[model samples]
Target: MKAMKRSTLATLINATLFSAVAGTSFSTLAEEAQAKSNQLEVIQITARKRVENAQEVPVSVSALQGDNLDAYSSAGMDIRFMNAKIPSLSVESSFGRTFPRFYVRGLGNTDFDLNASQPVSLVVDEVVQENPILKGFPVFDIARIEVLRGPQGTLFGRNTPAGLVKFDSVKPSQEFDGYAAVSYGSNSSIDFEGAAGTGLTDKISTRVSVLVQDKPDYIDVKAPGFEKEDSLGGYNEMAARVQFLYEGDDFTGLLNYHVRDLDGRPIAFRANLIEKGSNNINPLYDNDVVYHDAASRSTQEVDTQGLSLKLEWDLKEHTITSISGWESAEIYSRADVDGGYGNDFAPTMGPGFIPFSSETADAIPEHDQYTQELRLSSNFTGDFNYQVGLFLFEEDLTIESYSFDTGTYDEAAGNYGLQNGYAVQEQETSAWALFGSFDYSVSEQLDVTLGLRYSDDEKDFYAKRTDNPTPWNGSPDFLEGRANPSDSHVSWDLSATYKLTDDVNLFGRLANGFRAPSVQGRILFGDVVTVAESETTNSIEFGVKSDVLDGQGRVNATVFYFQMDDQQLTAVGGGSNFNRLINADKTTGYGFELDTEWVLTDELNATFNLSYNKTELEDDTLAVAVCAQCTVTDPTYTIQGPNGPEARAILDGNSLPHAPEWISNATLRYTKELEGGEFFVYTDLSYRSEIDFFLYESIEFKGEALFEAGVRAGYAWNSGDNDYEVSAFVRNLFDEQVVIGGVDFNNNTGMLNEERFVGAEFKVKFF
Candidate 1:
């Protein structure tokens, strides 16, 4: 009865997708898998712009899909589901499910601004989602997710020095198909998602997919002097996608459109969650309760739409392809920045020194992004093949930032509980790139490939501050500030693969990539716009891939070293309400990764992944401002800051912020034949070492190691080539809770990881 009641909404939503059930593009993906004489299936990837065996690819790549992907995203989880699942990869976000920040090989950006640039990029259906907002598109009906590690600039364009994540959706097919999935979990979490597709005609096919997620606020908020409305830990999000494919004698075209709507809360910055002198959580930190005094705070909303078209023409021995895309989004979010109400000015302030009350709102009123690419590839059955492409991109964005008073109210002067400061920033960006990849097979055991890309990037940026904080003394207003940054660079990579045996391969790769110049115009608190110059990286890696124990086990290992010149860095939240862009003279990183999979028995399987990364700045004269409260571990010296002589930490050899030293993951699956079906159990675990939240080393800002585990069990059976499944899942099995990020500008504020959740899921697919 409970299952039926929980699945009712999903049934209705799926019915809206059409009269068909939900899945199959993933199960029947490869026409020719080339599997060995074993139970394990062959893995396929598009790491080098071509579908090939994973072992044959020279670059380090990992893929997650099928039931595994479903298990992680059972309870309306966002894209952060990929965190710590693969070697050398981490995902975190301060904006909840809106903008996920990805780090590959310990290289990433930590700026929380709307216009921040990332070292890692995201590509959906071969079109780059360059903007941070677009990168959070709901994950549904995705056929496969590939993570290409290391420098991918030669083929993926700029802002890819760390790597890139690619998501490929299931395209329209001639046969009629559909699937529906639903899960009801703790926190009143409901995940309803499904897809439907069918052939309208012999030459035309279409597919539609939709997703809906909702959760109620479960935390209690106690405000002593004010009325509190919406609590934290709740959200309602919906997304839809539609695609049409047209196939001709020698041509094919595909058009896609998608939209997203989300209503959620901002990150709850727990004031003084971390102790002033230690890394551990303070005694006042409570997972299920909050002590916010701010009235009517915490509101967030986001809306986005995108459309793309792809066309391809097949010549006798060559192919030409074109892709065009456009995207736009708007968002408004307001939150109590200090995590509480009543500043030090009031005698009732608790939770540490309270400092001062800080409340702010950020909005993106206008945003537009356009991209186009043209490519030509050779399909000759010879030793040599090549692919070349030309890409163009443009974007225009506007940001509105406001500060509000959270203390006493003065209706006449609008002092407290009203708007205090306001600022607006606008930016326009244009970029173009020409990229090519060439491959040659010298023999049956040796293959070599080369890639090159030339990119020209530029940005036009301006910011203005119109209002100053009236509740307290603030920086003077500034206007008419302009910053135009531009640059051009050529990225290249060379790789080779040597077949050591029928089931083993050794590969080596050398690549150089660069992130384009970025401008920071977040002048809501600061008076000037800062720009970080182009940062480039040169990396080399060697690896071995092998299928052992009669193809029942697989192991892949890699060792890499890299050095970067003029590395871009962002100093955020160090007793300041601004993000400062800086460039390190030199930086270096080295790492090793190992991935292993084994079929212990016909009824059991296991997989493990591990990575160790060490990154450091090499400059001798690099220093940054230090936090006001934390116990500094680095040597501090006074420097002339915006105020006066301020303490600066010597960060010449400090590891990158949020870059963990070790990460590991493991999974185990067991199955047993049941009456007319199969009963299976799956469990997964991930762990990451401690990390510093800023350039300077401090005790309070360091995030301790975290380990999380999950389990899912279910029974599944087939009906006339169709599939049906019902499962019960538990995430964060141990109820692990730890701080994931920090707000250093204010007290010992900290953000936490996801909470424990339990749910039931059911899925139906028909063909």
Candidate 2:
């Protein structure tokens, strides 16, 4: 009954929103309401390493600007907010907000290790962030954001089977400009972001930006004999960026340096809250703000520093560009993995549970990354254009993880002589690629784009056990080994665009992409070593970009299909929570995306986007681990399997985890001119269809449709040459409880979404 209600509610809300937008569009068309408030701005992107109108780029991409960009950052500076606003994108993280895993069109990796490789690529200012920790870098300052869908192999090279999220920060200019924003919200949360830029000389200009956030904990512990000192959900994080630009008669150089410091609590896992094979929260466990813990707090600390330089020189009819980047970080996080104390783990028993509480910690004290790229492109206006580039990347990382028993408990729960089980892993990776592309105009109305890249990657891995804490563990020196793996692949893409009219175009694209091989060696008390071969994907897509209703509306749509061979997947192994990397035979995905922006009136505007994708494993002999709390409903649920009792389920037709069948986001904004300023009201709604958290299809491991809404209202005015605005906003207005990920090894542990936020914001601009 609850599932029915939730589904019905989502359908109704979506239907209502769809009808309203359609009706408004039709009504405006009938009345000829093309009063031209603010025409949709032309979005320019660098998807092809050159500036071009997004509509003419022959790619399926979305660009957010102005108020939309501001609203997204205001909701949350993390990349997860991009998932909520953009269609065909989803993000999940087991290691809190610092390590986010992204999925696009149902293509992504489920590995949570620091060195895990992902098909989806994240690029900030043309620099790729290879590590999961670096992907969590905060989004700040001005400029635009672009989400490119489908396989971006030709330009991005390896690990781009899914696509890319590209961020372009505002640059310095000769004219001075700056802005500041501050907000205070519920749970004693505070957010502040500001940037200032100015020209120092005829050849030099600089800009500085900063972001800060503080929030108090909101969870209360109800365990017996445990006093809740303060909230466990609080956080204090700060990030800053400095950019310098030097412009010459024939050359230009831009340098950027950034740093982030964070102190907060990671995601909390709730125990035994999810029912078997379903998204339904067990009614018997109705508490939402209560948690049990043996420790005072689950704490985390992270520090990151990065520097990048871009240089370009004009060489007659062509331009030469070079980019060099380096980044380093250290992170430490500890959490209550069990979600409860002794009563929950070994109920009806005394202090016998050795851990007293199941606590896990991960630390990465050594991490470094370097990248260099050199490219040359045509600068002349002609029927043909070309670009060629060479790229090199290197990384060094070390991680230490521990699952320990609290000292307060006795030996009944099986505590060995050691204090905890610990593993140390070290990895070094190097990659190089050569890529080139050509764009030719077959005629006045037709264009063709061809691109190709050859990439080679190698990784050196070392892992060993530092401690053994389990009762059954006899080898204190559990595992110590090294692996050196190398992979080489060829990626290519072909596309053609035909101009149907001055205001419309049609395009089709075919692309192939690949990800490097992976190694998993986080073994202390369990299995030895596990490794997965490289994976590759081929995709075909068709799309249309148009400006309709006499410049009053714009629409973009695409349909795509992809097949992945030798897909890398994660599986649970042996005792002591060891994870193994394996390769599945094949998987396929098909989807469609629709995006529309309409000017309803001179003072009102509306934008709607929807994406639907379906994915399934094509390998029939593949068996996967079932949900920890699943109640076997499939008639073929057999216990006889080669991968132990826990891994006895077949996943042949299962949809990919974290891939929702449907995702939609809509926004409406209205502006009114006042005597002294402009007043505006904005609201947005986002919805996602049912999703599974793991490969196997089980009732308790899936969630039904989820919906979230936000609203902001503000007034803006100008004083001389300065601008100012004040606004009040509310995010997740209804406080929807959504489950994003699951921990199936240790009971039915799950992670929940953030709570509601209500706040008032103030901003000022000066030039």
TM-score of each prediction: 0.93, 0.92
Q: List model 1 lDDT by residue over 538-587, tens digit each.
A: 99998877776566777777778898899999888676667889999988
lDDT against the true structure, each candidate: 0.84, 0.79
Please give, for residues 1-767, the per-residue lDDT of candidate 2 as tens digits: 01223653564345434433443464357357535646777888988778899988788888877888898777345667776578798777887779988888988877777778888998988899888888898888858888888889899889998998888999988789999889999877889999999999989999999999987776766555554745477779999999999999999999999999999987776766676545677553332354555446478899998999999999989999999999998999888766655544454322112223467788899999999999999976889989999999999999988776654444664532224678899999999999999999999999999999999999999998867655444555566868898999999999999987777778999999888999888775454677889999999988778776667777777778788999988864212356778888998887677888988888999999988787888777887555444553332444643344444567777778789989899999999999799999999999988887766666766766779998999999999989999999998889887777776665666777767778999999999
TM-score of 2: 0.92
Runs in model 1 lying further than 4 Å from the true structure: 1-38, 227-230, 408-416, 470-474
lDDT of candidate 2 vs native? 0.79
